[model samples]
Target chain A: MSRTGFQLPLLPGRSPSEPPDTQDRTRALEAKGASEQVGARVRRLFGGSFHLRHVDAGSCNACESELKALANPYYDLHRLGIFIEPSPRHADGLIVTGPITLPMREPLLRTYEAMPEPRLVIAVGTCACTGGIFAGSELVAGPLERLLPVDVYIPGCPPSPLTLLHGLLLALGRVEEARR
Target chain B: MQLTWLWRGLRTGVLTTRYPRRPERMPDGWRGTAVLQRDQCVVEGAPPSCVTVCLPRALSVEETGGDRRLRLDHAACIACGLCVAACPRGALSISNEFELAASSRARLISEHRPKGDRAA
Candidate 1:
């Protein structure tokens, strides 16, 4: 059977409908005021190309889903020069999700130590930030900051992809810093 | 060539959000952050009813300088929206502001003391 494919020629560019205001607001909110120095230092070291190592200390997997979305096309985190490295040895930053579970404590610590100097540990999701709803659970080991010095706190049951992007940008000093 | 993929792509458009610059368009049931209304809590009653229903126990009433104030740990909150719905006096409600990231843990905490109830 012979068939003709329908084709339309359109300029290849970001869709015009993706409203600019919302994205700007999210960026404004991600601005960290006091970390200006840290961000600048980090940017100089990595040239804004942040290599992240993700670890799920102990979580319900909600955070992982959002974390994965960072690599999706719409978010296009790669365009910003951010990447998820498979090994802590190659990573410049550790993006942790979930509450620090009892068993994962050792593993998490090892990952942090494995990272190179000028390293950053970012606690993404409410769980990693403050134990979240799992705080009182006997099986939980509390927040990540209690164990490792956290550089950035992205608080949410699970932060949105844009929030994650902004948090990374904040850490690298791509955005303005604010205190609040 | 079918070119069906191109047609599908054009129809679906971009699925990503334009957040940060403009505010996110949260759905009807989408739950955001929580805020405590001091005056409303007093009218409903001290040690607000929402505290009891809070699953994570993230909300607690503490006596500061002889005045009972509600403390909310934003990091511990799951954003389940239970407290927001449980409040009889509308003292607790979920805000549209979802960007809760901060450099310090202290910034995530919110304390609301009853209006006009000065600590001695």
Candidate 2:
């Protein structure tokens, strides 16, 4: 048997023929003018000052696990001047994970609508950015861009903690400065 | 950022799975698939315990004249390990061998019975 070509069966009730353009337009709109706004806010919140909020739409828990790992002693996201807030009102950015399942669409919209203006949205994991292997499933409503504007995207089956941190830093414009 | 990059580089080596080529290692107590021992099966009309434990109705027992027959549907199995535990005669065990890939789904089904053990 050829293991190289095996793929899990597509989730039930998914369309195999949907155009990819829908996702692209949404992503482009999200990326525009987002970095600049987030960068300004992050600059003011340096040194243990900013808080982030996380939402799990319908992920398999892999992405959420990695996100929580950031808070562990080894990663210590707090040391980088970042913290995860429980509420949208108190948050500067929204970290979203999962494939945005059908049942979660309304709740996700409600969460995004509640956040204050100049708020940044970061889509983490392949499930968030492209819905990964779940894209066409009836249970999933999106690649996230379909419902909410995404400022940054970090891709992986479930991205490593550092990859997520780098994405957050990119959104903050901290990595660019550090690059030079 | 240089410090972050150095830390990231060190961590990247540890992530990802080398699956497909090598048999993927499942977690402890992972239910792979059930194997049937033909020798332990009774050729008589005695009911097999595997039939009762399969939640998905993936297994069936048949009687041909006087022989007992057991059939299994591999695809319908969720690898729940119930049948393995239910086999009272030690005719069934759950094996770690998961590479049951087939070009056709029909090939995945399996049947077990003692050879030349005619039904009464």
Candidate 3:
């Protein structure tokens, strides 16, 4: 199989799409906005490589699928010099999905604090953007904006890979965000 | 040998979108975010009918100043088209403008000014 080309035969055993978890209807809210200074900081710090840490505070994992799709041949975000980092300590950006639940709040903030300065926080998906439909629930401590300064808001039940790309680029200050 | 893969690659063109450089668009009739056709809205009652059908509370009637307006919050909407189907006036329709990322929550909301009315 050519690594450059997508092969249909690969990963035949990957699990089917999971339904949205009603009980875990992640509740979070959008919080703060970053100054233009943050964008300049990102451009300087990342240079050509953007390292990100993804935090799933309380999502149904749909956004995770789209984030995974970025690695595939179709989206291929890696070619743009963007990467997902496992440790927050090494990241320049934090991309969060799902509504921040009660249990995840401390850890989410801890992860945010763990990152070095000039950190960019991107709220991915409806839940992290607006508390989404899960806004009224008692279980959520989110809209990520409530917790941290969100530099980009990618609002979707789950954002598409292309939308995710747009958000990432917006965070990098390479593209203009398309407001509704 | 490796030639098969090259042949396959040749057959399949570049799959990546022109996004960032060019805006991506969904196909026509693609059900994405829903918007209220303000000019066509014939709000007859205290609350618009679409509010009841919207499961996520994405649609709501807001009273501002002296005017009553319908607010559509895209982030809360699932694009299920229930509001489109439920509206008797066909005032609600699905839009393909799905590149709805914004820097703030307020940008995701659009308050429509109704043009017509059906009074009780």
Candidate 4:
């Protein structure tokens, strides 16, 4: 009922001037709950070391390329104290890319299960967040959140290296301002 | 920052392709699509190495007489560079032309004969 800063239109049969009770009920159901707002948690761990491990379930390699590009000279994400680890045991965060396919479901679950407590999952790309174009495919069993709690979501078909860097920074609570 | 920006700008210009309006010259070893050459095919029951070596199983040969007819399935092709390596007669070579857009998927299948081949 409330347009506010929302870009998408309200569903059909829902009037903008709905009663307060109706609006409250709708908002309660529609809200994405609350995420640990970017700045608060990050302030406590500012300048702390963080290791990321990337997982590709069944992507077209576009997202993986962008993720790799983050370490390139122009966008050296490692300069921000973020390192990409090869194993879950060494990682403090999981960066998942791709629409989780049926075969990849078990492996993704196993990888997430292997990570220790206090770990975070950052779903990078539309595929990982909401399954993107492959959302309803028979072969797809995910939108990573179905199996694990995703702490941060970076939305893009294949998010640019800079966008990914921003999301990681946001997850770490380093980027507090609403710059984008 | 200025030096990095300048370097990136130069790199972007160099990497950009002149596509759609201007035809792009595909770089060396770029796999465009598979082409069928019916002439150089050996029809005397000799094994067609091109067909056998196709990683995607995209190439097939039909024996007629002294000439063998070759057919290529572009959709099935993964462009793995095996078929080109198997062509003993040098009849098959990877083409650099990658502009394979078509209204119908069937048009992607290239049916071309080797140069100076009368049978195709």
Candidate 5:
């Protein structure tokens, strides 16, 4: 069977400790079919695909850098049927980074309000989840969850590119999971 | 040309990580998260053993009626290897568990009771 649309660059479903099998074609075929079905369902949820608008809510720029790396050849998040969009109006999801400061509170809400129905809010990095080291600050107003309905909370100082991919996949799973 | 780049791509195999779908191990000595080896912990000292040395305060000890419980908040942790080095009994060390994404706030906090106090 040919998997034409399957382009998950990361070696999913295979353990590194296990030696590579050259004669396990049947087992490999079954695994591929399962992940492909999941991919197809996820694609249908957003009507072919969806766009994400990332907002830096007064972050230290570390999360932003990791977010930027997703588009590069190494990570390549676009291959997974999701994209980084420029406009909130065109986006179906929001990837928020850093602790939301007083100045960013109004803009963040405006961006969330701009998105259409079935919108997803993903809080990336430690600051965005629980404000990390910047919790209970005088200038800060949010940890992303307090202001919006966050679907996923990726807790890391600056989550690695792969972690962001996993979070996006989890959010996609949630959309389908909720409907069921 | 685009064709030349395409040829270069075929030469260089896939480099993306396989995490979440499958476990990915971080490099040796890589500080992903702090772990408190409770069995090795000498609970004879006053409460808040390694909590004072923690820079982010991810480690904390709450003494409720003489029972000291060391709490490690993964959300607040910055992955700094301070607590591992600061432990006088050498009970703390770094582990390769970096995929710590969660949907709720309370799930991120973990508690470790010393050998004798297992009630709480």
Candidate 6:
């Protein structure tokens, strides 16, 4: 079997690419300039970074998978100065995923209590944000906000990595437009 | 360990997305945020199909003083697109937008007037 003509030629341009004469990058940068200002504010507030403690209240693990992807090479949250801490005491923010299960409620509260002052809570996914499909379940305690103050809410069955990044940035008071 | 691998890495260039700079490109047929078009729906003549098909209870039809309206709760939504497909009049659909983050939960709740009533 032959695998010819399946791929395009690599580097069709001349050796050592030259910058385009058109100002396309500037327009692209302008559209995202608001986020840059927000980044500056975030840096001023948190010293350019923040540590997070993620708690799986009671989810199907779908959200967890997406959250874990933030650390992967694709997202590389570390490049943005965001780190996930193992302990709540060392965390500047708390990222709660899934619905609040009955048994996990107390532990979740305790974890929140352990965090330092001026802490922020980000509710991730539909379940953690509003109980999702299991809203009325007797085994679950509903959304995380019922038990604690939620600073940011990320909505989706399992929000994409980009959405989560926006949520984190939103929590940092970096949102451009008011709401979606 | 080989020179070819280094060349390949250089050719691949940057993999990081230009998101927040340029919006992330959603996949083809991507379903993110769902919206309801009240003007397109026939709420008085037919039952709301979107409500019945929405497993998450994110879409609800509530009666308020002889008027029925649609309520879309962003928090409870999983973006399943089931409700969008169930709408007979094309009243509900998945939008390309994915930026659904908000500081206040109440801001995520949106209500639409029924077809028979004036849109608010």
Most accurate candidate by lDDT: 3
- Over A1-180, each residue of candidate 3 has an lDDT whose tens digit, in order, gives 587787333222222232223312221222122435455654775545788999999999999999999999877888777899999998888999999888787678778767876677889988888788789688888777766777778877778787788778877678876644
**DockQ by candidate, in order:** 0.31, 0.01, 0.44, 0.02, 0.22, 0.42
Compare candidates 3 and 4 on DockQ and give the better one. 3
Question: Order of candidates by DockQ, top first?
Answer: 3, 6, 1, 5, 4, 2
Note the chain A TM-score of all models in turn: 0.74, 0.77, 0.76, 0.73, 0.72, 0.74
Better of 5 and 6 by TM-score: 6
iRMS per model in Å: 2.6, 16.0, 1.7, 15.2, 4.9, 1.5
Off by over 4 Å in 1: A1-38, A41-46, A176-180, B1-29, B43-46
**Per-candidate clash tally:** 20, 3, 9, 0, 0, 0
Question: What is model 5's DockQ versus the real complex?
Answer: 0.22
TM-score of every candidate relative to the true structure: 0.76, 0.49, 0.81, 0.46, 0.75, 0.81
| Global fold similarity of model 2 (TM-score) | 0.49
Model 5, A1-180: lDDT tens digits are 457775434333434233334423443343333323434556674556757899999999999898889888767777677798999998777889989987787677778667765567789988988787788887787677666767667777777776667677766663221100
Candidate 3, residue A165: how far the Cα is off, in Å: 1.5
Every model's Cα RMSD, please? 15.2, 17.5, 11.0, 17.6, 15.5, 18.1
Better of 2 and 4 by lDDT: 2
Model 2: per-residue Cα lDDT over A93-172, one tens digit each: 88888888777766666666677766778887767775666767787887776766677666544665665666777677
- lDDT assessment of candidate 3: 0.76
Cand. 6 Cα-lDDT: 0.75
Instruction: Give candidate 3 regions above 4 Å deviation.
Output: A1-38, A41-46, B115-120
| Docking model 2 quality class | incorrect
* Model 5 CA deviation exceeding 4 Å by range: A1-47, A174-180, B1-9, B16-23, B42-47, B65-67, B118-120
Give candidate 4's error at residue B56 in angstroms: 30
Instruction: Estimate, for each residue in A1-180, the C-alpha lDDT of model 1 and write its tens digit.
Output: 236566433323323232234543443345324245445655685545668899988778888898888778777777667889999998878888888777776677677667776677789988888777777677766577656667788877778676676678767666543333
CAPRI rating of model 3: acceptable
